[model samples]
Target: MVEIEKRNSILEVGAGGGYLLNHAMQRKKKNAQYIATDLTEAMIKVMCQRSNLEALKIFYAGINLFLLMKLKIL
Candidate 1:
């Protein structure tokens, strides 16, 4: 397990059902900023509803991998 000394901004692309997102929230780092997004809308809905997840910040969006050469998230 990697210890997070400084909870920097995070962006999770292609986050499926947010299983990892739930785990990330458990850390509860004060400076943590989280963003979880998926390619499927249905999956995102289920994750938000069924998971009952809590985080500092969560973002949902569809990404086209072909168009994305490199992503710089801040």
Candidate 2:
């Protein structure tokens, strides 16, 4: 079983390959919808292609940094 991060670094900056997200999805503990929101468009495409999760429902969207500011996330 993959160890869950204490802080759950899902929204990390400069997360290029998305190793953490892919790792979590591989663990089929529950049937759940996973959302992969990234700051970079290239990362979004790469993760969707590399994840290769057959049974997982994934929603990958590239969120702009400006939008984050509007949402008061930053």
Candidate 3:
């Protein structure tokens, strides 16, 4: 489990519909920043439509092979 503190910045990758992030936001400090990213526009749209997650910063992004190589994750 991740421990969130005040003023912390949370980044959730591949956050489809933001189910977990939404739940985490309920318990997180108000000053904390939550950012969610997903590869698919459909999932991002779904998260955007969720009224409970209006405070979240949503983006469309994906990790490609080039990034993996650059990060030495491949």
Candidate 4:
């Protein structure tokens, strides 16, 4: 588990490839949330595959507003 003094929620907009998002998730283990958004189904699939199940609350959406409205992209 990572122990960072200052932890903040991460809102990644247009997380197309998901590589950066995946890395960010791995870096911070506690009190950190990740929200990934993409405009294509194929991209979302790739993103899901990159994410680990152990993550706390990793959210995925087709657009930023989907997450903002508290709804799934699909």
TM-score per candidate, chains pooled: 0.57, 0.44, 0.62, 0.55
For every candidate in turn, the CA RMSD to the true structure comes to 8.3, 10.0, 10.1, 8.0
Per-residue lDDT value at 51 in model 1: 62
The ten-residue window of minimal lDDT in model 3 covers 65-74
After superposition, the stretches of candidate 1 with alpha carbons farther than 4 Å from their true spots are 1-5, 53-74
**Candidate 3 similarity to native, TM-score:** 0.62
Give a tens-digit lDDT track for model 1, residues 1-70: 5554346655667777667765666663655666676656666666666565432333437433211111
- The clash number for model 4 is 0
lDDT of 3 by residue, 1-74 (tens): 77764536677777777677556667666666666666665676677666333423333374321100001111
Pairs in clash, predicted candidate 2: none
Angstrom error at residue 36, model 4 = 0.9
**Pairs of residues at least 3 apart in sequence or in different chains that clash in candidate 1:** none
Best candidate (score: lDDT): 3
Please report the TM-score between candidate 2 and the true structure. Answer: 0.44
* lDDT by residue for model 2 (1-74), tens: 43443323224345455676656545423434344455665665566566642222234474363111111111
lDDT of the structure predicted as candidate 2: 0.42
Candidate 1 Cα deviation (angstroms), residue 51:
3.8
Flag clash pairs in model 3. none
Query: Which pairs clash inside model 4?
Result: none
